[model samples]
Target: MMINSTQVSYFTLSAYFDTGLFKYLCFMIVMSLYVLIVGSNLLLVVVICMNRSLHEPMYLFLCSLFVNELVGSSGLFPFLLVQILSDSHTVSAPLCFLQIFCVHYYGAVEYLNLAVMSYDRYLAICYPLQYNTRMTYNKIATLIALTWLCPCCAMVVLMSLTSSLQLCRNTIYKVYCDTHSVVKLSCSDINVINVYGLIATFSTIFGSLLLILFSYVRILRVCFSGSKQTRQKAVSTCTPHLASLLNFSVGACFEVSQSRFNMSTLPNVLRIFLSLYFLTCPPLFNPVLYGLNLSKIRVIFKSLISNAA
Candidate 1:
């Protein structure tokens, strides 16, 4: 018998282990992390916005990336804190779907944002003489818009497809709601949704990856043939971007493996840690990586701090 999606009121998150008094400790730890993520990402966003000197394509993209960290963290941390403290690990249907949407959207935006940044860097490095002409304000605006809009559109369809499924169960095996976990509960055939989901995921992930690859290939050719100054310029700007990309890709791989494959033999604690790694780490990681690595942001940030002090 198929249960309508509307009838499934809550999803029980089976992965949360009983921690008893440690629940308070967990709550505090999670809360502290959330506060740090918000504070750091927000600081960078404000710094970029307030300082006219930092209003370049790269900084603008960084600002958007930092804002996305806020969006992704806000979607998960509060809900996680509540669940951590509560005896019941169930989430409301509407809230579950909302979390799913936010998580997916956050990921999509991050990949595309990185891809766009790579392209920007490509222009700056490969064609320095024409970088200004190529990366005009209007063009930057359009790139940013498409980066966000594409994901928003894809996620809306993903959410709709998942929401329409006739769920035979309401137990999601992870700490948070995700498309794969929720879809696993469906009583009806999910071939169409699954296929569509695969296509969307592939196009978003690989498509961005391809663009990044192409950008960097051309970049490498220039670095090999050009002067030392050209290589320095490429290294200084591209290092943080590459590091951030690699870190996020690792986390994403862990998530995909855990979600798509059977890993019941792994320790619950390890599994949980791996599952939360992607969402938790990147928000905190990106701000630190960029803030410390990029000299301009670092100098401006330090000045802002000293002046305030």
Candidate 2:
């Protein structure tokens, strides 16, 4: 697949802004949100890295998860802020596809990370005796590499197919450049994109989801069989992860459904907010849930707060 600029040099993004004042207001809100998202996630990552106590497998995975949130949010927020501030929200062909790749790449990596995190928890709770042996440093590195690499490889192919597409239009009615939304502009039959998209979505999201569910089921079984103290400990460790996973899954579903299904009955404002939520909610809340809920992380965070105070 190669680039052909005969059809499109750029794409005009959503004209969601109404007036000058509204644009400025929206700009402030999005900029502040971006700062908070980046700050909070990076704070968690820094805390985990600096604290020797947090260098365990679970905390390491938490660190990776926070980093993923940062990566995902960074992909959207900066560009979004710029769009809100500008009078014309035109994104170049290459840049638009790059954004699509980054955004989706972030999402797929996140699913893989969450799946790996669940499996880590499963090992810790379900097979404590062999957890250390199985989740070695080299093995952990390999898992992390796969989580990032698989999505990159998938997105590369997906984007390649998309770039070669014969575009029929150059306007996307959304704030960000999504592969599917952009693909909808193509004059050519998008059966290729549709096919590969399904494969990529299934491999990244459903495959990971199934693994997570299996791990949790096994963890639940083991938790029930263990003593009262073991059950309490397992529950404490697993609860925050389950909460994060559920929130992320819901957000992902909303985004996917909005794209795949015709929800023209839904108001524009509602759809816009839902799309923003799809991008914003997971990154903003994941750190809050983990930082507040996990005992070790919570304690360490509190100690840092107290010393500063």
Report the Cα lDDT for candidate 2. 0.86
Best by lDDT: 1
Q: Write the per-residue lDDT of candidate 2 for residues 1-309, one digit (tens) a residue.
A: 233448589999874656667878878888889999999999999999999999999988888888888888988988888887878889998889888987898889889999999999999988888989999999888888898888888988988899998987887888889988988887788897898889888878889989999998998898778888779877888888888888878888888888889877988878877776757998999888888878899899789989999
- Candidate with top TM-score is 1
Q: Candidate 1 versus the native: TM-score?
A: 0.98
lDDT of 1 at 220: 98
Badly placed stretches (over 4 Å) of model 2 are: 1-5
Displacement of residue 106 (Cα, Å) in model 1 is 0.4
Structural similarity to truth (TM-score) of each candidate? 0.98, 0.95
lDDT tens per residue, model 1, 41-60: 99999999999999999999
The backbone clash count of each candidate, in order, is: 0, 0
Query: Where is the poorest 10-residue window by lDDT in model 1?
Result: 1-10
